[model samples]
Target: MQQQTGIQTNPVAALGRSTISFVNSLGDIFLFFLEGVRLIFSSPKQLTKIIRQMYFIGSKSLFVISLIGIFTGMVLGLQGYYTLVKFGSEGLLGAAVSLTLIRELGPVLTAIMITGRAGSSMAAEIGVMRISDQIDALDVMDINPMAYLVSPRIAASILCFPLLTALFDVIGILGGYLTGVTMLGINSGVYFYRIDTSVVMADVAGGFVKALVFGIIVSTISCYQGFNTHKRTDSVGPESVSNSTTAAVVLSCVLTLVSDYVITSFLL
Candidate 1:
């Protein structure tokens, strides 16, 4: 007779534990978003803070976003041109590049870039504040941490992500133009006409919606991680921030991909 496996887990217990964890995570994010919204509505001078946050998130991220957008479009142009040339349809490269960027690549890559740039930084900043008891200090002063600390960040993310995505799309299309038309001799008329006729307001709107959703997820996850960071000694502070930043980036990416599918299904 075969021996049973050691360390067997109870199926019911495992399922129960997963279900509880999922529910807890869901509730936490809901509360976090709700509190942030409540604070935004109640804040008298929140516009100033939101504006500063926007500059930080939007302006600071602009260069990297632009750089990546152009390169990505050029790469798509090259690959797409070669692929379509096999079928003597190289003129359609612009349409291929535009559709790919607006429908999928733009929002996804922009979110990931923001996650790498600002999301990690946001998490670390919050984590540092938490570890140093700065959050508690705010509490002592009768300030709502959600308003002062979280609201501006979350709002800024929501506002900036779509705009960034839009810029990425435009720059990428231009890059494709540079590579496809200028380099490969694709007719400007055909390229522009195809892109114009093929890409509609609905495509851009769908990309915008994805960007907005990704922004909400990234900001909320990063802030939540920071708000709950564990206290550490001076030597371990860096380690704590590093861990929180990593967690924030990883969670942001995973959620972005998953939500992309969900949103795409509905949009389609």
Candidate 2:
């Protein structure tokens, strides 16, 4: 009878345990982020580290961001023109494209791209360090690994995400101009006019806010995953590093999208 009861409740028990584990993980990640942020201000010499990280996370990512932004804008211009033409509203294409890019796509796409590029690199680098005991060596040298590694990344991401998002918005606007004005015969003046009139400071501000939030999410999650590579249950050693990198990228992208929606709701 006891065995029968235990079997019947096993699935329920497993579900409860999983739920608890997930909640605990959330708590841990939050705490980890707090510690990293606190450590960012712990030392005055951190500016050099932050700058190096900025070059890697921001400058190195510029070309790819520009390429993606232009293509995305061009696609929007083409689709928006076709859709609006049906309603005799093709002239509004400029406003549509600009608003869509500024309010939504620009921030979200930039964050996702950076997650794939810099965030993955961050995870892999840290994960390798963990597997190789480089992080432990830092500890032995009396270095605070969190400050030396995680804090600089968080600082760089915070500074870079907004700048990158702004660049993306501008390039995307140009791409739309190429498609709409040069290709589809939209009046160059009307395109500029609509964009100027339609995009307000609020729209731009909201996009930046989203970028900032996404930066925090991506940097923290990637660093956390890498910092704890050895704790991954399904793999060990180098295999764990790979797994952590994959998980960091996937999770950062997901969280960026989720947070996008949440921020949009609040901003709206």
- Lowest summed lDDT across 10 adjacent residues in model 1 is found at 1-10
lDDT of 1 by residue, 152-226 (tens): 999999999999999999999999999999999999999999998899999999999999999999999989888
Please give the CA lDDT of all the candidate structures.
0.91, 0.96
Q: What TM-score does candidate 1 reach?
A: 0.92
Segments of candidate 2 deviating more than 4 angstroms: 1-9
* lDDT per residue as tens, model 2, 102-210: 9999999999999999999999999999999999999999999999999999999999999999999999999999999999999999999999999999999999999
Residue 232 alpha-carbon offset, candidate 2, angstroms: 1.1
The TM-score of candidate 2 is 0.97
